[model samples]
Target: MGVFLETSRLVLRPFGAGDVDLLVALDGDPAVMRFINGGRPTSREAVEARVLPRLLRDYPWGTRGYWAAEEKGGGGFLGWFEFRPVEAENPAVVELGYRLNRSAWGRGYATEGSRALIHKGFTDLGVERVTANTMAVNTGSRRVMEKSGLTLVRHFTGDWPERIEGSEHGEVEYALTRSRWERTRQPPAAPRP
Candidate 1:
């Protein structure tokens, strides 16, 4: 598959079968998986059987649900991003998500990629709404969602199979609707005289 989207510094491309090692290495980092699975390192067997299958699946609209994020200049795998519909058959509402290596953190990559994906969702993908969720304690993720123009929609506990460190505090949902996005979009600057 070809590149799904691109920002000035990142390229989002569809994942391939050859990308298993990248996923394994990414999920092996404890800090990266802290909130995801309480720092448990995922086995290659799991990634091959469970994780990769989900990422490689195509949606009803003919687009893959997940994309591998890479640095534009270096072409290094950063992580993956999710922009799949909430319902399998509907394209109206899609879930937005990302999982980047710790080295990619604090560099504004998350915010940059997120804003671009949200823009693509509303402007080109016929998406009516974009939603994201993270543990309430994850202030960094929350900030990225806010920076991408999503606002807090709800806070609720999820029925996860396993409890993590911050599960007690619950989770939060942030969202932006196409109408709100249109109203808040900044117009292009006027040409200088």
Candidate 2:
């Protein structure tokens, strides 16, 4: 399998046909699905029919897409990370997202992977902006975004298809522009002649 990115403790790679079971199990966990689908488990049929196909075709314009995150030491599947365009109409701006197993929570895997991808986006991919959104009550994800250098850009309600527990609190969006990201890592190589 081709690796997309790497961190100190994790390796991010593209999903393969063999990853269907893994994806199903990850989305099946209630705790994992709590914030995402109100604790509803994704069915195997759905994973095979819709989800996997969608993820496979997701990356067209950007170098980054949905990647499976595995631990480097034991080579276990931790979760997946997405670094892709926020909208099909806009390729300059990318979105950062992650979904980890409940066992992998609180261990900084999310933040570490996110930080690495953000760095690559700014320094390698020429991405203009990176954005992320989460439920307002998802403090864990918000903390990860903050640690990854994304600042709160907006807070507004969304028209979600399903009613979730924390939907009432609305959602928050975090973003970092290439200019802001570069400033944080200033004093780089000389400008292109």
Candidate 3:
């Protein structure tokens, strides 16, 4: 009984306790979790004890949280998308991210889900900006970020615990401000402001 946002091929909906199975299945896929965990599987206990709790905690801060993305026609769970604020001190901003089953790749679900979330941020959530980050070698995610209208903000290097292959060149952040999003949403430009 939560609200759902529908794109042409996917639907984004609120998370529920019943989603543990879906999370396990998604995290179990070696191909899906390759870059994230070096193909290691995530245990259900870890997801239940730590991941889900942290994911849902953002609800109190803002209208930003993870969502379950499903195929509109079949109702199959593709994966999840996150539109949550990066909880930190001082001014904060929302971040966009997604994780899909291997079957969901090359199907445009990432782009569709991301675009819907970006629009929801600016229009419904009053978010002034949205950003996304991925490993520098993560071309697929970077592509989704750019296709969703975010420009490269910076490249960040972190001491990742897993140390995947692409972690070397560092991670990149992409962002889109409200004004930039508004411009992309418009039909045609009349004149400069």
> Candidate 2 vs candidate 3: which has greater lDDT?
2
Estimate, for each residue in 1-193, the C-alpha lDDT of model 2 and write its tens digit: 4777777788888888899999999999999999898999999999999978766765555444788899986689998998888776566799899999999998888888888888887877768999999999999999989888899999999998999999999999999999988788522122123
Q: What is the lDDT of residue 185 in candidate 2?
A: 55
Give lDDT for model 2.
Answer: 0.85
**Clash list (residue pairs), candidate 2:** none
TM-score of 2: 0.91
Off by over 4 Å in 2: 61-64, 186-193
The per-residue C-alpha lDDT of model 1 at residue 141 equals 97
Q: Write the per-residue lDDT of candidate 3 for residues 24-109, one digit (tens) a residue.
A: 89998888887787888999999898777765554544443888899887779999998887654312378899999888887778
Q: Output the better candidate (1/2) by lDDT.
A: 1
Candidate 1 lDDT: 0.90
lDDT of each: 0.90, 0.85, 0.79
lDDT for 50 (candidate 3): 77
Worst-scoring 10-residue span by lDDT in model 2? 184-193
